[model samples]
Target: MIDRFLDRLAALVEPTILALVIILLAWIVLRLTRATIQRAVARALQSERLSAREEAARVRTLTTLAESAVRLTVILLALLTILSIYGVPIGPLLASAGVVGLALGLGAQTLIRDVIAGIFIVLEDQYHVGDVIHVNNVSGSVEALTLRYTALRTLEGAYVIVPNGEIRIVQNLSRDWARAIIDVPLVPEEDVDRIIDILRPLLAALPSDPELGPLVLEPGEVFGVESIGQQQATIRIAVKTRPREQWRVARELRRRILYALREAGISAPYPRTVMIFHPSSPQPPASS
Candidate 1:
């Protein structure tokens, strides 16, 4: 019985030591690979013209993705190696894994598509976290992004999850710059040139205002007489502003324009009703 026990222990020692070594080697490889990827990404980004914040975000995103892939591969390889050392047949295991993978691929097509789309989104820099975007008829700020879905926080405080595969059109509202457009309607009898004259100075002075100066990118332009209708004429004014600032600028402009129009005693357009009074059908219908 003692000899039998000793023989079993001897048989286990080599495989156990080999498995430990393989695990240790995998750990070392993972650490080195992560460091190398970080260095490579940082070095590559130095040549691009990006803000410090943008650079950091991209680096972090890419490094995380690469690390995850590498870790998964290394772990699978280490597990296979450990199994083989224990005299487990690997051929059948590999065949079974392939079959399972094929089955999963067919079963999770949507998931695969979403992951692919997410990868492209990150690579193309379509949008990033904290960016205000319009996708799938929903306008919101990106709260988080992952391989399968993107989380959004709408202006109304609703949290939404959207599959990446469903995002066919992406409208990034906070890219670089934005435009503020305001249309002012007036009574048709009002002189458009006079209104433009009043608006020109107000718009020109926008860039000098303390609160709005930083947001304004260029002086406002008045596109006179966009359209003339029976009761009202539309005058369009546009201003270039910093990104995400267009709505605020537009609101401010509307308020200022309202006050100016009121102070100038200019009447806004209102529907007019005409009542025609006629004698009752000449009393022809009263023959009861």
Candidate 2:
């Protein structure tokens, strides 16, 4: 009875110790892999000129992807080792996995393509979160970026999700700088040169104002009479500004122009309508 008990204890203790060792090794390797990946990413991003918040976001995105890949590899290796330790033949399992993987590859090709495209986008720095971009005929500010899709918040408050694979062209609207070009329509009878002169003072003072000056990189310049029509003439006002600031600057300019023009007794152009009373048309009753 004693000999049988000793044999049973020995049989159980060896496999338990071996299994624990295998698990420990797997854990150590996972930690090392993660550390290495993080170190590599840090080194790669050292030369990138990014703001503190932007850098953090970029780091988070890339590291999350790297860690996910590492975790999958570690899990697969650990699972295989454990199965082998239990006397399960891995050769047939691997063969079956390859066949299934091929089938899944065919089924999820678009998913794979999207992830690959996303990786390239991140690497190339084509665009980032908070950038107003145009892709796949949709224009919006990027709200979030992932390995599969990009989320955008439109000006009208609509959220759009675009698959990375479908993004053939990426037009970044807010990159280093932005320009605002506005057409102000006026009476065709007004002198083009005189209108430009009237707008000159407002344009000159724009870049010197405290609040808006920072947003404006260049003072506004009015291009006289962009086009002439029967009723109105289009005057072009252009300004270079910091990224995303052009909208605010443009709005402010419009407000100032409207008030100034009103003070100067100049009227903007608008469509005119006339009512023709024909014989069959109804007319107002005559006062008694």
Candidate 3:
């Protein structure tokens, strides 16, 4: 009985241990690759002349994506290795998988499309995680971008998950520089061209302001009167700013312009108050 047990152990134990070793080695390699990928990403991010927060965020995003891909490959390799150890012919197995994949493709074409689209999106750098984009009619900031889906958080604090394939057009608001636009209302009594001229010099001098130098990319521009109203006309001022700085620039520009207007004694149009008299009122009506 002892001899028989020893023979059985020799036949199975050695190969099982060898297979375990191979799997461990594969895992080690996977970890190394993950580390290397992460380091490369970090280096690339650091070399960029971006803000500290942006650099860190970009590195984090690249690392997460790389890790996710590596993990998926490891899982697939492990499964294939196990199948090989069980004497499954890999060639036949792969051929059968191809057929099965074709069937799945027909059934879930949208899923495949989404995955492909997602790959292009990441590769092209159309938008990244934490970017604010307008996809189709939906506008949100990206929380996460995966191969199959994208996670977004709207301005209203609502979270949305959309399949990548469904995004027909993407308007990335956080790409390079954003525009800060403010419409100032002035009474029709004021000259539009004169108001523009007054603002142009002030706008040109924006880049010279030390406190606001970093946030603004260039000077602002008066885009002309966007609309004319009964009470007042609206003149639009557009200021270009670094990504994510548009809102802040808009607020600051508005404040500065308001102060300038006040200092120049340029008054805004106040709401017109009209008094109405009824037929029964005692007030006499002006007549010829």
Cα-based TM-score, every candidate? 0.75, 0.75, 0.77
Candidate 2 per-residue lDDT over residues 52-81, each given as its tens digit: 655655676677678887888888998898
Model 1 segments more than 4 A misplaced: 1-43, 56-64, 67-92, 228-231, 267-281, 284-288
Candidate 3 ranges beyond 4 A from true positions: 1-16, 39-67, 86-96, 191-198, 265-267, 273-288
Error of 1 at 265 (Å): 2.3
What is the number of backbone collisions in each predicted candidate, taken in the order shown? 0, 0, 0
Candidate 1, residues 216-235: lDDT per residue as tens digits?
A: 99999998888988778899
Ranking by TM-score: 3, 1, 2
lDDT of each: 0.90, 0.85, 0.84
lDDT of 1 at 259: 94
Deviation in angstroms for 182 in model 2? Answer: 1.6
Model 2: weakest 10-residue lDDT segment is 51-60
